[model samples]
Each structure stands twice: as C-alpha cells, then as structure tokens.
Target chain A: MKYRHLVITDPAKLIFGTAPYPVKTRRGLHIGGGQVYSELNFTLPVMSINDQTLPEVYAHYRQITEGALERALQLNSKGVILEFETLLEMTKSPATGVEIVKIMNDICESFYQKHGLASEIRLTPNDLREFERPALQRTSRLLEPMFQLFEQGMLAGGDLLSIESTGGKEVSDEALMMCDIKAVLFSLAVLGVRDMQFLWEKIAALARQHGKIPAGDSACGFANTAMVLAEKKYIPTVFAALVRVISVVRSIVAMEQGAVGPDKDCAYEGPYLKAITGIPISMEGKTAACAHLSPVGNISSACADLWSNESVQNIKLLSGMAPVAYMEQLEYDVRLMNTALKKGAAYSRTLQQLLVESDVYTDAQALVLDPSNVIRISSALIQGDSYVANARNGALEFIEILEETLASGRMTLPEMELSYIPVLREELQSIPDSESDFIEMMLPLLDPSKFIPSEYGL
Target chain B: MNYILSKLLEAVEYGKVDQGSPYPPNLKGMDGAHELTQKALDAGIMPQEILETALIPAMGNVGRKFSENKIFVPQMLMSARAMGASMAHLKPFFASGKIKARGTFVIGTVKGDLHDIGKNLVAMMVEGAGWTIVDLGVDADAESFLEALSNNPGAVVGLSALLTTTMINMGEIVEKIKENAPGTVILVGGAPVSTDFCRKIGADFYSPDPRGAVEFLKQLAS
Candidate 1:
C-alpha cells in the first residue's frame, strides 16, 4: 500500500531508466535508480526434455547463458538481468529448475567477480496451476512445486523471485472472447485481485525469509492474451487496450502485498503499474519482436527501467545463438537509452518523446500506453472507491483519451472499430460503482461452472 | 421463407440469444433465437431444414463478418451463443438420426499448455458448421489425441498451443500420432502456429482464424 495516489502526477516528469523508488538486488544491481539494464529472456528450442535428455537440457542452458554473457562483455554493457522463466517440466522436477538456477547464478557471479561487471537473474517458474480446469485450487498438489522452485531458486543465489501466475485466466478466457467487459473486470479486478493477494503474500513472505527481492507479477495471462487475440484480428484492439488498463489493478496487487519494483517484462500494463506504484518496470518493446509481433514496439520502452527481449530460443542464427544475438540487440537498445540518460534530463526527455511519438498514433493499444496517458489513467485508478470501480474508471479514462485522440484527428481508426468505442463506453459507464453490486450483476451472466465464486471469497 | 425461420435467422445473425438478453440494442424486446427457433420447430419445419437454411447460414455470415473485420470475437461469440441456443432445440433431432453431421472434429490445446480460448472458438465455429466436435480440453497429450482418434475413426484431430514453449509439443504429438496411426489427418493452430510450421510438423492444415478452419473442413467433407 505504498502508493495511495499517483507518484509521478505530471507526465512530463516521468522518464525511462529510473523510478521514484528503485529496487536493489542482493548483488548490488539497482533496477530503477539509473541505467536502463538489458533483461535477457531466453528459452530452449523446439525440443522435448525427459529423464534421458536431462543432461542435454543442461548443456543447452549452459550454451545460452555462456554465449549471452560473452556478448554482454563484448558490448561493454554496464549491467544485465537474466530472466530464467522455467518451463513447466522444470517446475515439475524442482531439482532441474534449482540446478539451472545454480548454473545461471554461477555464470553471472563468475562474470561479475572476474570481469568487474554486474549481472542478476530473475527466476520465473511457469504458473502450473493454470494447467488445471478449476485453475484456482490453493491446496492443489500442482501449486506447491512452483513455490518450492522459487525457494530453491532464491537459495541457489537467484536475486529475484517472480512468476507469471495465471490465477483468473480460466474465467478471463471466456469473457475475453465475448468482449464481456463486466465479466472481464470480475476476472481481473475481483477474482484476479484475490488470487494475487493470496499468491503474492506467500511469495513476498518467502522473499523476506530468504532476504531476496520479490519482483512483481504480470497480467500476461489475461491482458497479453487479449493483445495477441486483437493482433490476430479476432478481437478489437480497443477491447485489448481497455483490458490492458483494467489489468493494472490486479497486477498492482503484487506491489500492495509487499512485492517491490521491476515487474515482469511481458506485463504491457507495466507503464500504469510504474506510474501508480513508482516501481521500476521491465518492459519489452522492439527487441521483443523476436518473441511476438506487437505494435507497441516503441511506446513500450518509454518508461521502462529494464529493456528486455521477451524470450528468444537458443537456436542458432547467422551471427550466433538466438539468445546471444538478442542479448546484443538489447544491449544496444539499453545503451542508447542509458546514453540519453547520462547526457542530462533534457536529452532523456527528448528520447522518451521520440519513443512515444513513434508508435502512439499507429495503434489503439499503443496510444493508451503513452506515458502521459498512463499517468492520467493511473490517477483515475487510485481515486476510485473499490477495485471494480478502479478498473471501470481506468477503462473510462482510457476511452476518454482514445476519444480525444480520435476527435482531434490525431489518429484514424477503422469505422468498425470506431463505432465500438461508444458501445464500450456505455457498457463501462453502466457498471455499478459498488463491488458487491457489480459482482452480483455479473455472477448471473457468467457461467457458474466457468469460475468458482468461493475462490474469490464471494 | 417461413416467417418464424426467417426471424430465427435474423436473431442468430444479430446475436440475440433470448428475449432476456439486451444486446444488439435494435433487437431488444424481440423474440430471440431461443424463442424463434422453438416457434420454427412448432411450425412443423424440419430441423435439418432450419439448420441448413437459417442457423448454418447465420453463423456463416457471422464468420464472414469476423474474417472481413466487420465484427470481432465478441460479436462472433454472441452469434455463437445465439446459435447454441437454437442448437439446443435441435440436439434431439441430431441424436435420433433425423439430422446428419458432416464429420467428427476432435480438438485440444497441446500438452504443457492450458490456454483454450482460441481452441474453443474453433470448436464453436466448426460445430456451427454442422460437425460433431469432441473437445479434448486443454493440456491434452499425445496419448489423449490418439485415444480420441481411435474412438472416433476417420475424425480430424486439431492441436492448439498458445506459448512457443508448449507449441513444440505439437511436433512431438504429431510425430507420435503419425507413428501410431499413419493415415491420421491433423490440424495445428495457435498464435505461434504458421502454415510453414504446419508443414514442418507434418500437420495437414493450419488456419490463423477459426473461419479458415471451417472452410478447410467443409472442403474435406465435400
């Protein structure tokens, strides 16, 4: 609850490579104070690993990590963050994830201790609870292994504990397809908020016990899902944009429950999270083109403390391994931003403006992410009385900015999409301000079997 | 066209599920697909005729609007719901063999993946096109697909995965299925799936949208 109101009220004051509050890792890596670090996210190629392939899996990870670090040194990057987002099998076999954690941490320490360079690891285990139908069984056997892996990762000298926990995804999946804003809000603001509270409480406690940084969670399973659907033209981009804003309430719960800054890279809602909580955020933009195609390639980096490549595989390319190539790309991107930062405040502001302007008018998803609009939407978020109201107001604020943008002839959207704005506006405005009333109204419309109300403490 | 049948078509086209649902503002307070469909049945219209002339065409229009970007997932999903309401009244006819299905389509999100919105959408669209869908649900492994195929011989199997990590499982699943059942036809899809990947993975088809999958199945049935 550190943020009662928006910390950076004036959008002009908000800049990349720094946050009002920065998170310092155990190895003296300051995530948000200054210097935009490159957070390299890499994964295995299209291969299955079993008991017989365990040794090969280790070899692949070693190659990717060693190759990436070698590139970092060549680029002369000041600091880098290696995010080891474990695959599902890694979590199932906790020893495998822990061993990989140990291997990555050893490489990072060796690089730092020998080369006088700094690096850290953000160990994210896949949230396996999402693999189940009910998806929210707190006591399920599948749930504990994730936390066990996190604990093991911390003990293995991993600096950050994070997970892309998919709490409300089961319900959000259906709501997203129907564009049911109320149901979407319930899934994210109510069900997701409760899950974040329960999940992050444990994670933050574990971090405290281990004296490690509990980096934030993401709405990747929710908003990022919508964005991908929208990108494929299956859903309206405006719907995805609104979902992104509303997602901040649930994601910020990670912060409220004692998790500190430098939230996950894929949480495109990171801008709003950063604006409200003053937590440094890791954002992936142009460099993330290796993972997925997105229109926010430029705007995503406008307020980022860590510029990331979403996750490239260890496959080889003309230059070298894919992860190594991506590390080089991320280093250059961070170098430009860090260079702007070093020059002075004016240079940083100019660079931020260029990043904002490059992608703002091209897409609705990008427009809502403009740092100035993030401040405005986040301000409305804090002023609201309840989580549901906060999510509603956030969506309304996003619509207002979108409408203003469209009305001013700054951006032109397709007629089909343009017509849906008023429809969404009316639907958002129709929602009751009280959380209970909103829940009561939405419960009947949602398939009771699709979600367990008791899981949300209804 | 019969008035009730025509009204049922409009209801499905506009996504009016029932008289209680307040969507497509213009159609509020009107008898929706649920009511019109029942009235059409009571009027002695053949279930297959209603499905062929009204329900199927209505979903076809919805899918067309979706592909053309005139409508998106929400509008199309509403239409799917309206079609579902109408289909409920026709299920007895289908079970009694009074109406025929095109073919069986078995689908699931691959192992190590739980995302199913896209898979569910394909199921809905394909089912709306008059096919029997055996949904294997999410995290369905290779054995699940083989078991489903053995149960429904000559069925088309569809595999889906949202993450690049889990999508690789599709290749393994496809390989296992091919090794066990050489002539099995498989379709693969998801955000990361491309026609190129489809060919590389030995899948028979890959469609970026549900409408394209329906089209491919229609031709296969033909």
Candidate 2:
C-alpha cells in the first residue's frame, strides 16, 4: 500500500521544547562540515564512496542506503520518510544523481519482484536556482523518470503519488509570487497523476517584502506585518526570521496571544497523523535546524534539539538500532545543577536561577525539582547547552557539579558504570582549572587497583 | 639544551601561551612559548635554530597529534596560537633575511561558500609548517586566487570549499587558475572533497584534514 498524507514537524522544537522523545541515532553526516555544494543544499565528505566508480563503492552506497531505509522502516510504524536534503546533495551533481536514481530503481524493482509488493517513491525538490537555466533543465529532467516510477508504483499498490517543491529562489517580488503560484500548480499536477494529497507551503508576501526593508525600523515593521499575514494564512510552518532572543520571544508570544491572528489550539495531531499515514511532512524549522547543526550542535540548540529528537526516536524504531550511550549526557547538567543548588555554590545558583526563570524548565520542572529523581539531568543539560550560547552557563555549572561529584566518593564507581563516564572524563580533562584533578579522579574511578600511581598516568 | 627545546616544544604542543595563561593544566603558571622563545633569543641561540629546532618540531608534533585524532579543533587551535606567539618574535628576523620561510602558499575558500573552519585549519597548519600563507578568507573567487599568485609568482594555491554546492565552483576555479597561471600547482580540499574530485576538478592535491594539506605543501616546497 502507498502511504498517504504529508506532515511536517519541527524535530528541534519537539525534543528541546516541553515535549521530548527518545532518539536512537546519536550521529550522522552533518551539513557544511566538508566540501559543500551550496547550490545543491547539502554537504559531503571530500573522500566519500561516491568519488569511486568501483563496484564495491556502489555496493557500499547500496548497503548504507538500504540499511538506512531498513532502519527507518522498522522504527517507524507509519511508513519510512527519507530526508531528501542529504540525498538531494548526494545526487545533485548530474552524474551522481543519475547513478543514484538508477541504483535506487534497481533496488526497488528487485524488492518488488521478490516480494510481489508495489514500490512508491516520492521526490521533493527544495533547491531551485534563480534564473539558472542549466540547473532548472537538469532538475526537471532528473525528476521526470522518478515521477513516472512513482505513478506506476502507486497504481500497483492501490496508492497515490505526489511531489512537492519548496519553491525556487526568492527573486523579485513578482518572481517570488509567481514561484509560489507555480508551486501550488505543480503540486496539484503531481497529485493529479494519482489520487494523492497535495499540500503547499507558501512563503508569505510580507517575507518577500521584508527582504527589501532596510536594516532597522523598516525591518521590524516588515516582520510584524509578516507575523500578521502568516497567522492569517494559518501557515503551519512559519519561520520567524528574527535575530535576537527578545524578538523570538516576542514573536512566540504574539503567536500565542493572537496578536498575529486568532490563536488556534496547538496539538500533536499533525505529527501523529503524519507518523500514521506514511506520508512525509516537511517543516522548515526542522530542515533548517538540521542544516544549521550540520557537523555538530555547537551554535544552534533549536536545530540540534530537533535533530536529536528525530534521530533518537527514529533510530529506536529502526531494527538493529545501536543504543546511544551518550543519552545519559543530558542528565549530567541536571544533576550538577541540583548538586550546586544544594551546595548553594555561586555558579550553580546562577544556573539554577536561570533554569527556574526560563521557560525551558517548564516540562522538566517537577522532575528536576524532585528530591530523589534517578535520572542524571546534568549530562543532558551539558550536551544540550554545548550548542546554544544561552545554555553555556548551565553547562559550566554542570561541569562544576561533575568535578565535585568526582572528588567526593559519594558519586561512587557503581554509578560510573554507565557509558557517559569516559566522555564526561574527557570533557572534564579538557577544562583548564580542573584538568589534572579530573584526570587524577578518573584513573582511580576507572581502575581501583592503581588508584594512587595510575591517577597521574603512571 | 635538548631538554629546553623539548620543553619549548611541549609548551607549544599544549598551547601554553605565556607564563600567565592557565591552560592545559600540566603547565599552569609556567613560562610558555613566548617567554621561552625570548629566553632562547637572549641566550644567543641562532634564530634559525629556534625556528627549525624548537618551533617547527613543536608544530609538527601538534600537526601529528591532530592527524592521529589525539586532539581536536579546539586543542589544535591552542597549539596554533602558541606557535603564533613564538613566531611573532621571529617574523622580523625572517623579514630582514636573518631567517627564511619555506615558501609562500596562497589559499582561499571557493566562490559562493562562506564557511571558514576547514579553510582556517588548512591555513593554520600550512602556516605552522613554516610556509608563508596568503589567506583569502571565505567566499573568495578565482580572481582573488589569481591576484595573489600574480603578487607571489610560482606560489602554490589551495582552494577550500565546505559546501557541496561550492564544490562545483571549485571546478570552475581550477579551470580559471590553469588558464591564467599555467604550471601553478593547485590543491582543493574540504569535507566534500576527495582525491577523485581533485582529479575531476583538475586540482593537483586533495586532503581530508589540514595536516595532509600541510604535508602536501611541504613536498611541493622541497
């Protein structure tokens, strides 16, 4: 059967926001860490298997993609939804895209033949160059066969086929408006190929006009107008292009208070339905966040949180998904903050106060405030805060607690049996003030036999 | 004497900026590369000896550690900082011909890409390896690379691209450099670059990490 409906959810908002879920995959390829092809909107390692034409290389690619698909299928009870961004990046180069499609087709055909099952594939094109004729031509040609295959697959499975475009470049006001209109038409046309659902995410007119606004008050006025328009449109996926936290807070508040338009009761139905329907939902915040946190979660918590959530839950749903020992890290910061609060340490006090004051604590407030919660909240805070600047102080406070925990035997080697000790040790040693002390503490914790001599790397 | 040089090397390797900087724990409050280089200078140690014997070897160790994954970006950055501190004292000597740099190497990220971590790493490693680096920061196009080459003829060129989209720009850059400055060796690297891609783009070299680029430049200089 073919999956229906396409829902877009923000992965970052889900994880870091009051609503958190378990994720399975701890790591994957990040965007812009290596040789990146910007036009394609993805990053790849300079020395990837794609560079080689050997059969073994092709096999490796097949194996990896198959593994990814298998995992996604097993983990997601609803149907597999593959991210097009990375795949798009890998296949954007004309030759590579052709090869990848050929390989995917061959795989699907083989699977279909073996199981007497129908194979339906959806292609989402997000990066369309502005006025770049060659790119447009290549993209169109590449999409044609895929669309045909999707139609055939849908017919075989009693399903429907669909295609969606993120719309091309934001050119002139006129051009952007035309692109939006064209996107709706194109989506409808694709839907017409089969009995499929068509969903169009439009860029607000105010956003288009905001691009023209000057650097100051003009921009603010444009932003306010964009919010009003977005709310009016009931745009499910709205990106507040505000720079400061105050602005984000204001926008969110505006959204909540009906300043933009009538406030709708927010529910988890969109994600829940998308998960059940087997249709892919694309959200701007989630994809944008993934791109921002490409290699690591150093600068963007909003993005990193979403990636962490999706990776965790999706991986858990997939078969043979390896358990991420690093999940315990989130607890580190929480525990440390607790310890500091108990000790009434100055550093801890500031962090604890921030946690108390910030909206971030709303969900975890009961658990964090509990006198005897078993979960290690310190590491989680540390890991989460590692990417966002606002979270750094909390992370630092957690580190302080970790240092004290190590110093006091009360932390006990028994509790260190978890996978996070080594990582925590490394992080501790990386600190300037307590490096030697942490190293000394860790050696004994690692091996009780040589607590004295081995503590100094003897 | 060897012990002092080793200590200086250690200082640089661990990022001991000076006596005052309390980083890397083991050498807290100890005299760092800055102090040691000055002391070595005052003691009548030859400037060349300081560079070749003390600073270069220290940076080499840092580069090796980086390649082996024993250290990461932040650590490598610290070592580079330490090396820079030491190099500051020796730069004027090199300028006056009392000392000599290996050679000049021009580097820049390809057009349409603004990311800089990879480019910065390559630039630092190449500079630390004793070559003069002409860094044309992020979003640099072919003309900038060509202009730098014109000023420093025969200098090796390196192009960095951290985006897949920009890799295509690298191909155009390689072609442009070849057309304008024939015989100039060009190296391309970044997360998405491979040896095969280097060949496809007509670049002379490709390395996954900064150390490999530094080693390649060393070979070219030799």
- A184-246 in candidate 1: lDDT tens per residue? 898888888888898999999999998989899989888988888888888889999999999
Query: Where does candidate 1 chain A have its weakest 10-residue lDDT segment?
Result: A131-140
| Tens-digit per-residue lDDT, B183-203, candidate 2 | 999988886678998998899
Most accurate candidate by TM-score: 1
**What is the Å distance of residue A374 in model 1 from its true position?**
1.5
Which docking class does model 1 fall in?
Answer: medium
Query: Model 2: share of native contacts present?
Result: 0.03
Best by lDDT: 1
Please write out the lDDT profile of model 2 over residues A1-458, one tens digit for every residue.
12122112332221111122221111121111111000001122222333554355455435534544443333321121222122333334534444544564455455445543223222222232312222232234544443333333323221211222222111111111111221121111111111111111111122123221000001121222222222222111011111111121111221111111101111111122122121111111112332222111121121111112111211232334222211222223223423443554454435433432342222111112211111122222223211121122223333344445446643332221222334433442343322233234333333232112211123
TM-score for each candidate, following the candidate numbering: 0.95, 0.46
lDDT of 1: 0.88
